[model samples]
Target: MINYDLYIDGKWMASTGSSRIEVEDPATRQVIGSVPRGTKEDVDKAVAAAKKAFPEWSRTSAKERGRILRKVGDLMEQRKTDFARVISLELGMPIRHVEKWHLKSSIREAVYFAHMAENFEYEYEAEGGWVRREPFGVIAGLTPWNYPMEQITMKLFPAIAAGNCVVLKPSQATPLCACMLANIFEDAGLPPGVFNIVTGAGGEVGNCLALHRDVDMLTFTGSTSAGKEVGALALSTVKKITLELGGKSPLIVLPDADFRAAAEEAVYSVFMNTGQTCCAYTRMLVPRKNKEEIESFLAEEAGRYKVGAPSDPDSDIGPLISKRAFERVKGYIEKGIEEGARMLVGEVPGEIKKGYYVKPVIFTDVTNDMTIAREEIFGPVLSVISYDTVEEAVEIANDTPYGLDSAVYGPAEEAYEVGCRIRAGGVHINGADAHITCPFGGYKESGLGREGGTFGFEEYLEVKSVFGK
Candidate 1:
């Protein structure tokens, strides 16, 4: 029975628009809550408040800003249980994973950004005189439904640490967690209008935020097509834009790699977060000689993933964010079948009965040009393509417009070499896990700018070179 409202300026208020978005639990197909369908008017009010807060907020001492961030982190940690529950219920993530990874990981990211801000050199002597990193004034942070807290924290923490005010627009599908985040900032005593949350459709609130004249920067995380629109709109006013868009990344399995280990890691990499991750390794490139063996192993491993209720502790996969996403994933599965890709594992549209569930799907003998291999499905679907040599593997991996992330699986030395040759921003060797302290982003259409560690902090800042005295 939680009543969600837009957090504009320093107060929680109802949207001026007549429209409202109903939040639903994908697993049960039940309406959880309703969020206001914010309009351009709402975006204007938020940007205005942020602009007004910027003068004082940007001038605040870095130490004080860091202190505030640290306090926000502490508050979030205290409410970890509640946050995890909300995420699991809203996003249909397993409760155990929500606690182990989503909630805990997001808190760590905030803490990491706070620590980085404390020691960051805002002003430093360089070649001629001094260089300073200044805040970009008001920033609009548009986050996605998947990894709601993580995405929000990734953008908002760094923006605030760099002394900028933020107007965050979390996805209407999972706006509850963002509301809780706003509560954390309020309880942490963040200055009025320094942080705001507005929930609505991307067409309305997102577009308005990007086109708002007062907004100095627009940070977006979503699909490539949506990103194109946001980028174009932001460019109209020439606002600074940081886009972490879609990725159809590749995971290369060298001939000498352990077939069992590679297959297991590949399935986990692509299927985690229900394959909704922007950088999910959807395309797997294996040596032609070992294709049959790897394909068999992948089929076996895919079957092991238990897809069911999010509340079930043993459930390995959950429902898509909504009915639309469910249909989209189902449609892609069907497309793979029609396009001549062999369905090596799982069924199309998955088990029928309830919710927005889709079983893990694997396609073998897939070509790079196939729709399943080329497009970003954003589902628990994997396409296995065979490559004749390491050179061909690199070519296939680099063929995609995205360069967000890629993985090299083989003997330690050989994998390292291949990783060096890959064009992605982050390369995982031998299934090495994602590191929070490292910079994360794509090289090409994957994204603009990074979103982790000190590299991420730079996105919220503008460099100014001071002339010699």
Candidate 2:
């Protein structure tokens, strides 16, 4: 049993409040560990510590901060196996994917951020003036459970590199991984209070951190409703805010495309991480003439994904983060059925009964107004809608409330042309590849700011213009 505690001011401490959050392994529905259920008092202590440490940390050279970040990345690499196991146990990602992609990708994000920080321009001269980018003191980082380490790394690395201290509040669903991350920062010899972790419910510790006047900026990754609440709370003090919110992205397949290949890629896009990712391509648009053929292909591909224990190396899909998520996804699946969407593959209850698992569900004849097609169902549920022409396809793809990401599959030239017309932060053309360095975010309500690449670093920085001096 791994015993975990909150990290504050370079020391491990118990929660200031009288509550504890028990983390469970979704695969087995068993309690894996418990973390401090922090409160407003805990948030106060963390912000005070960060505020005190900011002066020294901000004074440190950029190269020195980059070196420390590199050390942290190295430590993360050394403990890849340990981190992978923890992610599998707590978040219920397949062990193989956790080791192969999740752990390594998170480490790479840190290392990449460090490399970017080394060459980032903190100050530049303009017409009769100089623009300076400085860190916002005491950032409050609130990350989600889906990609705990990746999201935290993306937020913390840049904030620290930009000379800011952080008070991170990772979701209670996967707080153990956050604790492990705190240990890595400690091992890397970061300055006292430069990085701290507070684990608890969003309404308690998370809200407190967002509302804390001492916190200069607030960065959050989660649902839009939650984002709105956090934004509202931060408005009290007018703190800087950056949000990476939800998505119901689309994957459009033209009649000229290879149906088989597109179907496989579409399934992979949404089903990866059990469809918990914010940028998952949940809605797929196909040519009306080839709708039946595309549906057959999608059903065949969906049946190939094996949903089971996260510990199973060969399992393609694992249980959700908790029973609550499982129930919520199930309810959405039921709503889709009641709304008259045709279920082509997988059932609501699915195969597994003991764990919080739902198999891949693909719904055909789904209209844009259907609940499954319109709402952000963060599960392995795919909705297929039909379009008559290229213009119609583009219209359908952009009809949703989200504009975070979209994919176009067809002839290279046609796909590229359609990709240009879509209003999204990022577009995948012909399943080319997902660029880590590209700016990732939405245009409207999907998110307020970008994450990944150079734009992400700018989120933690404040700009000041110095008059002719």
Candidate 3:
């Protein structure tokens, strides 16, 4: 079993408080590890460390910072197997999926940001003078459990690459990966206090970070309600906030699109990670005339994803992060039925008694006004709503409060036109893959700022114009 202490000032030390939070393996329902339950005192120490390190780290040469971050990325690559195993156990993701999606994706993001640090335009000419983008100093990164490492890295790497020091509060549910990252940075020889981690319940450490006087910026990734709380607190302190919140993202398939391909992509998009992703295409808009044909394709594709133990490399789907998540998803499934949406694919498996597994569920004949279609369920649940015309599909896609990510499949020209009309941060066209080079985040309530690539690097920076220069 893994045991962790608080990481402050680049040192692993015991928490000021005696409380500890036990980490559980959702698949086995067993205590796998524990981390210190950090208090306000811990947050103070961490923030103090970051505040101390910020001046020097922020002024450090971009090439030097790039070199160090690249080393961290290389070390992470060496420990990829360890990261994959630990995350699979902690988050109950299939080992292979963790390797591909979490470990590798995070490593790539780190490397991408590292390169951006050296190559990006830190200073550019303006109409009257020179405009410089400088670090915002001490940043507090509040990340969630679903994509623990990726979420942390998405915030941490870019912020650091832009020359900001950070205090990270990873989700209490999946803190192991964050602890491992602390070790990785130390091994890569990052300066003391440049990076720190405090693990505990959000009410304690997270809220403290949000309201801390020393914090200059706050970047959060989680539910919209939780984000609102964080944003409100951060706003009180006037700290710059970048939030990547929840999404009930939509995927549209035009009449001229490859029906079978779109259906398969829709299933893969929503069911990846058991549908816990914030930007998942949980709402699928298809043609009304091809309803049965689309349902058949979805069912066939989803059947291939076997729900089993996460340790099995071949397991296509794993348990939810915890019993709470399982129950939450089940409640949504029952709500779908109550709202008159027909279950077209799978049901909540009543036979699973051990693990917190929910069968990949697809609800057809779903109206845009239904709960299944309106709410962000954050489960392996898909709501397929039929639309008669392209304009109707666009309208249905934009009907939700969320505007995070969307997908379109059809003839290149038509899909591009449809994608332009959708109000989202990122839009994928014709089965395109997600690249680390692109900016990621949301529009509307889905989030507040952009992440990834140059946009992410800029998020941690504050612009100043030299008027007299």
RMSD values for the candidates in order, in angstroms, are: 1.4, 1.4, 1.1
TM-score of each: 0.97, 0.97, 0.98
Q: Candidate 1 on 1-469: residue-level lDDT in tens?
A: 4568899888999989878888888999888888899988888888888999999998888788888888898998899989988998899988877877577777787778878888888899988899998999999999999998988998999999889999999998899999999889998888999998888999888988888889999999998889889999999999999999999889999989988888998899778789998888899999898899998899888878888899998998888888888889999999999999998888888554678888888999899999999899999999999999999999999998889999988999989999889899989988898877898888888888888878889989999999896
Best by lDDT: 3
Candidate 1: global Cα-lDDT? 0.89
Candidate 2 lDDT over residue span 309-391, tens digit each: 88777898998877778888998999999999999998877554678888888888899999898889899899999989999
For model 3, give the 10-residue run with minimal summed lDDT. 345-354
- Model 3 Cα RMSD, 1 decimal: 1.1
State which candidate has the highest TM-score.
3
Q: Write candidate 3's Cα lDDT for 170-220 as tens digits.
A: 999999999999999999889999999999999779999999989999999
By lDDT: ranked, best first:
3, 1, 2
Q: Global lDDT of each model?
A: 0.89, 0.88, 0.91
Candidate 3, residue 372: lDDT: 89
Better of 2 and 3 by lDDT: 3
